[model samples]
Target: MNETTLTAGKPGQSEAKNNKMGRLAAASSIGTTLEWYDFTVYNLMAALVFNHIFFPSFSPLVGTILAFSTYAVGYISRPFGGVIFGHLGDKLGRRWVLIATLMLMGVVTAAMGLLPTYFQWGILSPVALVTLRFLQGAAIGGEWAGSVLLTMEHGRQDQRGRNASFTQIGPSFGTLLGAGFIALITYVLTAEQFMDWGWRIPFFSSVLLVVLGLWLRKGVDETPVFKALETSENKADLPLKEVMVAHWPRLLISGSVRIGSDIMYAILMVFTLTYVTTILGLPRSEALTATMLGAAVHVFAVPFFGSLSDKIGRRVVYAMGALGSIIWVFVFFFLLHTLNPIYICFAVVVGMVFQAMMYGPQASFITEQFPTRVRYAGSSLAYTLGGIIGGGFSPLIMTFLLKEYNQSLPISIFASIGLTVTLLALFSAKETANKPLAE
Candidate 1:
């Protein structure tokens, strides 16, 4: 079979017959939203219920710390998930991997909602929770790369950034949804009611959204580029190995490119919630509200920046965003510490918007670094490595840093990391704005 034989381009159709940015964006957004919903809900739970429900035997602070450690467990599992699914996706097809990842995320999350609490089942409860979280981590590890690749490969080459941004909006959308649900539950019920049963609502509700996403994704066509490779029998024999040898430098650079975005995300989305509600004497609803609003702004900023990348180039857009992060980390933290809800909202929303400049173009930018044959493995490996280094330990580190060096130190450290990675990414990669899809 050849590309010509496998494709049904019809008489006048070229890439346009296969590329449909609108359809791809819809599919990608739904898939991304579902996966992120599963991934971030654990963080929400950690912020609130996990300490009491999963680690009840420990001191409140100790239990909270232990529960948050479980959240980090998910990130640790992501790379192996990437390796396994990346191999399968590179070998089988992007569509298969997408379905598998989504199902895994949905089932694990729903089961988590139903798990016995520590009071009911002893330590096995936390053990069960951590194991389920690992599965969600692994599922998301694979889900993100596949979702981004599907959109990018199926979209018009010229608009890859915008299309990919739509995919990345999954996190922003998922974060907002997760926070909103928790907020609503918190608002309607007392803290005792929320811990007793309300937390389960968000987790269990994942089933419906997952089903819808799977259905939408099923209707989407396989990426033309992957189809072309499969038809030509040109799939890489060992995608990970090949990528390691041939594009090793790029894999490193791409991994670093994501650090800035992920660290900012952890700080803005996860840690800040803890900071405001716990440290500043703000209500849980108020902190979640600010985070939710920031996420809403992030949704818009993601696509806007992604579309901007389509015109200006990935590097220029990303560098500007990274520079903003390096500059804003201090100011953002300062405002949050002020304990004024209005200023806190402004600070977080601004941080999220600046973060979006890098995130919006991220999916397409990373995927474009490799050819179709190894795109799945390469992008997944690089992207997950970034997540682990940048996001996985960030919250924990911030918690530790705050304990030792006061509030300002954590932001300073994170900012330094963002600036370092930004420089490395800018210096290492060529601008990929209008580059033709890899052959």
Candidate 2:
């Protein structure tokens, strides 16, 4: 074909390409959403019901801490999950591990939704719930890293940031979906009824979503990158060991980049829920509504900034996000302390937007940092370690901080951590813009 004909065909071809990307993005987004739906429901339940339902024997304050501890169980299990599934994903292919993890998460979450409360079964009920939460955590450990690799591997090298952002969008979308579902259930039923039977709707609803996500996933072609590794016979013999031996520095750098992101996530997702209801004395519904709205904004902001990273280099965009997070850290708490619900919502939305900058391009940057032989292991290991160090203790630490000093102390701590990590990640990491995949 002539150059003119080939150039003209690019538009039509581009549409086809985007359609494929959209499908891949949907599969990744929906699977991650359902996985998160299962995981985050624990947080929502922790905030609303777990204290009474699971840990009713403890003092109210003790119950809250205990409930949050169960939430942390999931994050704690993440590294093990990453190691296990990271090895599997690298060896068995991303598609199978992805599907398997989703199934495992769905089963555990549904069971949690149906399990009797501590009021009925006593301590066993809470123990059961904690066990299920751990399973959900491990499954999700595999889910996020695998989903990011799936989309990043399928997309063009130039658009990896945007594509990777789709995976990160899962949390915001899942949070909104879970929150919205709970809101609807509450609206349809009385407060007493919601606490009695209505709270289970969000968890029970996940089955249908999982099936739909699986259906979408079945149609996707395997990632070209994975296939290339398989064909080139360049796959790692011991993926986890290879990842550690060959890519330890990249893994550490990537994990550092995640400290701010994970802390911000906890600050926004878990701690803020407590801050509003306990300290600020806002109604739980108002707090949830504000959080739901902030998450709604993030669903768009993440992808927009992800796409923006396609034009600008990854480092610049990520550094901006980190800096924005540092600024927002103090402001987020200050606004919440002010106790104006509208201001609470505004501060949260802005904070999440800043969060999107780091989150949007992170999966691609992490994945791109390593070669395909150990890509899955490297990505999952780095990402999970970040979650463990950055997020695992965030709720606990924030609680301790608030109890130890004042609210401002937590904000100061958050800003310092965010700024320190942002600067470190900004200066140390290589820019991945226009870099070839599998390089």
Candidate 3:
């Protein structure tokens, strides 16, 4: 396709074609949203319920640490997932990889709900949980890049940021769904009941979501970019090798640019969720509710920032978000320190806004850096590697910082440092908003 033809709608194209594109975007978005819902449910459970259920033998602090460590296991496994699935996605196709990932994540997540507890299974309980969590990590590692490519490559070039932003909104909706479900159960159940079975419901419910996601994804066509690559002599025999040899600098920059948003998400959505109720003595329901509200706002914020990137530039919008993280790192903790539910909600919502700003433009920004033949491997590796460094250990690191220093100041500084790396990345990256996919 020529530049003008690919970037803009062809003259006399039917309205049905436009509608199909919209549906494709919706399918990609919804599938990713469900995937994230499964992941977030696990994260929230790890923070609140997993320690008690899976590591009952350990003391409270030890059990919590172990649970978060298990959570980190997912991140550690993501790079392996990225490489394995990324290689296949670039070689085989984006559709089949996504379908396989969805099935794997759904089955593993539901199995988590049915697994025997530490009391019933002895040492085997935590081991099973960790095994499932690792699989979950791997599935997600591949899921994200494929899902973004599905929409972006099919979308008009000028609207790639907006199309990719649809996938970014998934996390917000997923977090909202996961947190809202857990919050509802917590509100309705007694503390004993919640610990007993309330947590399992969310995990068990993932099967229905998986069926829906699969159905939606099955109807969508393969991305035009991947299809084009398949017919071209330019296709690499080893996409990963090509990525490393030809695109290492772009890969490193893509990963570095992700540091700010990933760390911010880990700190705000994961660590802070644990911090408020555990350290600050806030009610569990209150914390989840505040997070749910923030997630609702995030749904809107992602698309807004994404469309803004199409106008100004990806780097500018991303830099704004990184800067927001630096400024809000302290303010977020201060609001939580106030001990008021309203202030707590403000803190979480503001933090999500910053996160959305970076995440919104991120899919197109990173994908645009690489060509279609190696796009899957390149983007997935950069994103999941960033997940490992920036988000994977964030909760564990935050817990350690709080335990050692007994202050949020140290944690804020840690977050600021990650954002600084992102700022440097933005400065280094070429503006990709106007670039064609065939470049």
Candidate 4:
């Protein structure tokens, strides 16, 4: 089936295709949105709430280290999520796997809201928090590749970049919602009330979003590409095994490609929240507002770059973003260092735009690298593993660096090093646009 994102034609055919693709895109987006929202929300809570609530016995610095350490543990579990859900995705279907992940995240995130603090549950509290984060990470592990493929496979070959990018909107939306929701909660409540109950509101609200996601996904058919793969009876019973054994090189490239974007996102979106508040002595609202504004532009930037990739090729756009960010990281810090809100917002928005360039095309880029038989497993593993390498521990690393060196330059330099690796991977990756979707 040939489908266009924009089509004005016979109501019965062209319009139907467009509607179908639109619905699929909408449904796919919720998973990614939830994934990133959860990731972002947890980052905020770790920096602001968990370090104090869950690890009250430790020094503030050590407590934050512990909070973020739990955050990193969540990333460590993504591969398990990838392996489990990816096997089911490749063997069973994308639609159900997505629904399953949504269900899992909704439950876990809400559970996080109900968790007892250290003052209440002692060691059991943090233990439970870690367990929930682990489970939450696992749910997100399957979301990225599955969501990207959800729309990409249903659209026209030539427009795969734009189609895949439709789902990429999740991260920015997630960041926006997470930051916006937390910002609102913080604004309304006194700091004491916020620490006690306000943070739980956002986590509880995730239940509603998950319900909406499930409703949107209901009755949605599996992607035509996956359906065809199923009919061919070419399914890999253990898709993760096949991917690891047969496509490790592609896996390396795909995973490395994610490192820069993941790290950049963690920096621009997540770490800055910590930096601005703890280091600069700004109000939490200031940092939240900066990150939120940056994510707002990122929402538009993603599709723009995704479409650009179709014209200029993925490598050019992806590498451009990677290279641009390497240089921009320093400028980003300089702007932040000035202690000007206007400068801070400007730095974050530009930094996010550069990240968007790579992220916009990433879904199509990585998914196109592997055959449909193991596409879910291959793409999920790459994404989750890269998050582990870059996004997972970055906040912890940046926090540690600041404590050790009392400077932001090392943080910028460290971020640049990861983007440099991303550029290398972008060069090594085959240009996948205007090519057949691997079967």
Error of 3 at 244 (Å): 1.0
C-alpha local distance difference test of each model: 0.83, 0.81, 0.87, 0.88
Per-prediction TM-score, please?
0.94, 0.94, 0.97, 0.97
Give the runs in model 2 whose Cα sits over 4 Å from its true position.
Answer: 1-12
* Model 2 whole-model lDDT (C-alpha atoms): 0.81
Candidate 1 lDDT tens digits, 1-439: 2212223456767655545556677778877788777766889788777888888877655665687788888888898889889999999999899988888988999999899998899978888988988888898888888888887776667778887788899998898888887787888998889889888888899999888888878888887778878778899999999999999988998889988888888888888867776667788777887889999999999999999999999998898888888878888878877888899999999989989999988888888888778989999999888888788887777776765665666667765676677668867898777877665
Which RMSD does model 1 reach against the true structure?
Answer: 2.8
Tens digits of per-residue lDDT for model 2, 204-299: 889998898889888888777778777788778999998788778888898788888888888887778877887778888877888798899889
lDDT of 2 at 51: 83
Tens digits of per-residue lDDT for model 3, 131-219: 99999999989889998998888877888899898888888889989988888888889999989877899999889888988988899
Residue clash pairs of candidate 1: none
> How far off is residue 393 in model 2, in Å?
1.4
The lDDT-based order of candidates, best leading, equals 4, 3, 1, 2
**Per-residue lDDT of 318-389 in model 4, one digit per residue for the tens?**
999999999998999899989999999999999999999999999899988898889999999998898898
lDDT against true structure, model 4: 0.88
User: How many residue pairs clash per model?
Assistant: 0, 0, 0, 0
Clashing pairs in 4: none
Give candidate 4 misplaced runs (Cα > 4 Å): 1-12
- Highest lDDT against the true fold, candidate: 4
